[model samples]
Target: MSGQDPVSSPARTDSWSSKIDTSVAHPARRYDYWLGGKDNFAADRESGDAVAAAFPTVRTSAIENRRFLRRAVAYLAREAGLRQFLDVGTGIPTADNTHQVAQAIAPQSRIVYVDNDPIVLMHARALLTSTPEGATAYLDADLRDPGRILGDPQLARTIDLSRPVGLMLVAILHFVKDADDPYGAVSRLVSAMPSGSYLTITHATNDHMPPEILAAVGDADAQIPFQFRSREEFGRFLDGMDLVPPGIVSVAEWRAENEAGPRPSAAETAVYGAVARIP
Candidate 1:
């Protein structure tokens, strides 16, 4: 990573203090609580459990999503020789995090994690570890602020944009509504990377769940104020790029390491994952 103008981890200077809100449920903390972490509050646990009740597979889906992240990073680092990663919307750290999986495959793999959640920022200080030959840094910025991410000094300090980087956006785009120009957000960031760079993204969708499940998740998402796009909408994030084999499949089916039951219908799973290369 290389800082454009002394860009450093957003937490490098009390960044965590600036954005934390304890009164409400934030997605990052809620996700941390789901992954069995200690950084969340009562509000987050309540919200998480409520959502899990509506969708009984919520915890399983979360774990599968994380496993997909590990598989993607391992493939990128060991098979593709990808040494750097810019993981946007990285929720709270958990077992087999991006840097851990990548560095395990390639000791020199460097990673820069971006998330706007203050709680995530606080935990990232301890969770985002790197190997002796590799490095890891965290960025306290929102997904909407791609410019800040690209220009962050801490990111620049560790990553070299000129090389092929694995841009991981697993399970994060659902929080980005259509009004936010999610496509534009992805474009601006991917545009900054070189041709060989890869884009790995997973999004929540309603195609798999029944109407009741959809309605429940919809109500919950409304509380968070984000939109879950359809498959077509999710594919738009890959426009102008080349999707690899098994294009735009479910997270469980995207080059999966083990078959986890027959792939659930899109609506039932509610999550879509894809790996693409910037042409």
Candidate 2:
């Protein structure tokens, strides 16, 4: 047990999930519940319901945010010509993960996913399945500790930071709060990347919502602290970087022309997204 690979070992997976205190709500599980996933527990459902009660469009917001993640990764892999990705705060493995989307375009693409949740770690094996020509790794790390993530040996072995890589902060930074200096942490990671590197961010915002809509939420996401920012504040995170076309639009409208159905309105989604290059 001492030397076993936690991600690939069934016993380790059970060990990890067993340690989770199901009585309390967690961000990862809450998010999973909002996305109609079965991995969440009663506490997560309770939390999700509270948030949804306030923001009636929350479930739609969650779905649209995921779509932004997929489109951003595809653009990085296909359009930006990036083969390496560092996706921090990657939640539960879904239908089209970062590696799945990237490797579909470039079979040789490499990716490293980082998340703090033990449940996410339990599912790490699912995230690790990569194309034979490519490679994938998971780091059980927290976003607050950028140093640990940036300097991790597991990450170093998977993707070379000296080369261009895609840095994904999708829907995770808002949880960090201003006290943690999310912007500074982001800058540290950006500095580590080479000039051609790209950053993709999708964060919840109250900028589009009307006054009553903002009041409706009433801190329903209390289980996890969220600093709902403005469109300008979200854009500040990408300052000095070159934004991709249709910059900093609602999550639902970002390159959604190819999507099947009509995109949700900005106020309904209430999430700002953008992809920018280091240049």
Candidate 3:
């Protein structure tokens, strides 16, 4: 955002840092640890290690998930010509973030990143530098409160709600348990986007796991706030949108032909991703 909004992510984190309880493991921090980011704490490392011990390819899974995001953003910006993006649960800014990748393809693309973690926001302002042609801003908000996010005046200023926007919920919904009404939160966000807007997601899944790995994953899940859904259960978030080509496959395999190297297997990735056109 324009450095004018007081509620912007960059300005709020310094104050919010005081309230962050580093003793407990947060999903964003833990994921940062998994991705080899130095912004994470000891608790995040411990939690990430526990999950990695149970599933050795989790780092690969995380890497592939990021790859899936780049592919999706390229498709949205290059092929679909979507000029706006809303990336929720955007973790610590890394290489090829939504804004970076989209702006690379379309210099005028506008992006708003949403993350509840102040640490993530702190790193975002420092690292997620936006292009002069494009606009980029971060929102320190929770996914559970869709109305609050959509109604924010700063969001309206950054992106035009009337235009087609790419709604990205990548590798974050697993933290939203059923009790929190994840479906409702997704539906509300989808309702705000206009027709031709796309909803892109890469969610953790247990559909391809063996029983032994499931047991290990379950052990790790006990320590975190994760709920790996089956393929059928994951479909609840689709909301009748028209699926893009290669519908609902492993994150590593989604439009992977565009890449140069070999891709991870479905069982190895264990994360399902897809892009859909909002009809």
lDDT of each: 0.80, 0.88, 0.86
Which regions of candidate 3 fall more than 4 Å away from where they truly are?
A: 2-11
Give per-residue CA lDDT, model 1, range 130-167, as digits (tens).
Answer: 67788888877888889999988888878999899999
Q: Which stretches of candidate 1 lie over 4 Å from their true place?
A: 1-19, 259-268
**What local lDDT does model 2 show for residue 19?**
82
Candidate 1 weakest lDDT stretch, 10 residues: 1-10
Q: Any residue pairs clashing in model 3, and if so which?
A: 1-137
Please, what is the TM-score per model?
0.90, 0.95, 0.94
Give the C-alpha miss distance for residue 116 in model 1, angstroms.
Answer: 1.5
- What would the per-residue lDDT of candidate 3 be over residues 200-237, giving only the tens digit for each residue? 99899988888898898788768677889988888779
Better lDDT candidate (2, 3): 2
> Candidate 2, overall lDDT?
0.88
> Comparing candidate 1 with candidate 3, which one achieves the higher TM-score?
3
Give the Cα RMSD of candidate 1.
3.2
Ten-residue region with minimum lDDT total, candidate 3: 2-11
Model 2, C-alpha of 225: deviation from truth (Å): 1.2
Runs of candidate 2 exceeding 4 Å displacement: 1-15
Candidate 2 lDDT for residue 237: 92
